[model samples]
Target: MKIEVSLLAGQQLKASFADHEIISDQSISAGGNAEHPEPFDYFLSSMPMCAAFYMRKFCQQRDIETTGLSFTQEVITLDESNPYKKKVSMKVTLPTDFPKKYEKAILAAANTCTVKKVIQATPEFEVELVK
Candidate 1:
């Protein structure tokens, strides 16, 4: 999967991934001129979505019935000196009727989620300037 982001102006960017598109703007407190989701929100979203995706697949395979699911994340930036470094904590909520017996199974599945694994492993990236 590939995503592309183009700068529009003044802390606003247009992002596209396949059929989806979004505009990301930095927070006013962060010196952005527009009101839109910031990059941090998008990073937070990826973790939960990854877990949800795998949870659905796991439930299907185990014949589990899920009426609803939701997740909340708390990201703590430990060092103001390094804004990019942070810790993410997630709380996953399943339906009330979800079987208790499968709790471990579901958790195991969540652990296997691609984004979760990536976060845990702390993947490396290479940055370069292209003209």
Candidate 2:
């Protein structure tokens, strides 16, 4: 996928890919209006969001009821010196009447998130300036 990103007013940024346009901004204290989610916030959410998407797909495929299904995630930094070193603790909450047989299957389904897979694979980045 090719995503084009460009700077917007203040601390805001815009990313365009295909037919989608995503906006990111800094916090109020960071000279931005705080009108949109910060870019890093999106990064922090990608994992759990991706997992939730997969979980929903799993449930939908089985015609399961997702009326009360939910998920939560907490991002914990391992060290203040290096923010990159961190852990993501995720919780899956199923309805009280949910089928007990799918307990482990639901977790396995969530684990199928592409973002988590990519993170586990540890992708490398290459940055260069264009003339």
- By lDDT, the best candidate is 2
Model 2 Cα lDDT, one tens digit per residue, 38-65: 9999987898899999989999999999
Per-model lDDT: 0.83, 0.93
Residues 1-131, model 1: lDDT tens digits: 89898988889998899999989899888889758889868777888788888888988997877677666678889899999888878777888998988888887877777877876788999989999
Instruction: Give the TM-score of each candidate.
Output: 0.80, 0.96
Clashing pairs in 1: none
RMSD of each: 2.4, 0.9
Q: What is the Cα-based TM-score of model 2?
A: 0.96
How many Å off is the CA of 17 in candidate 1? Answer: 3.1
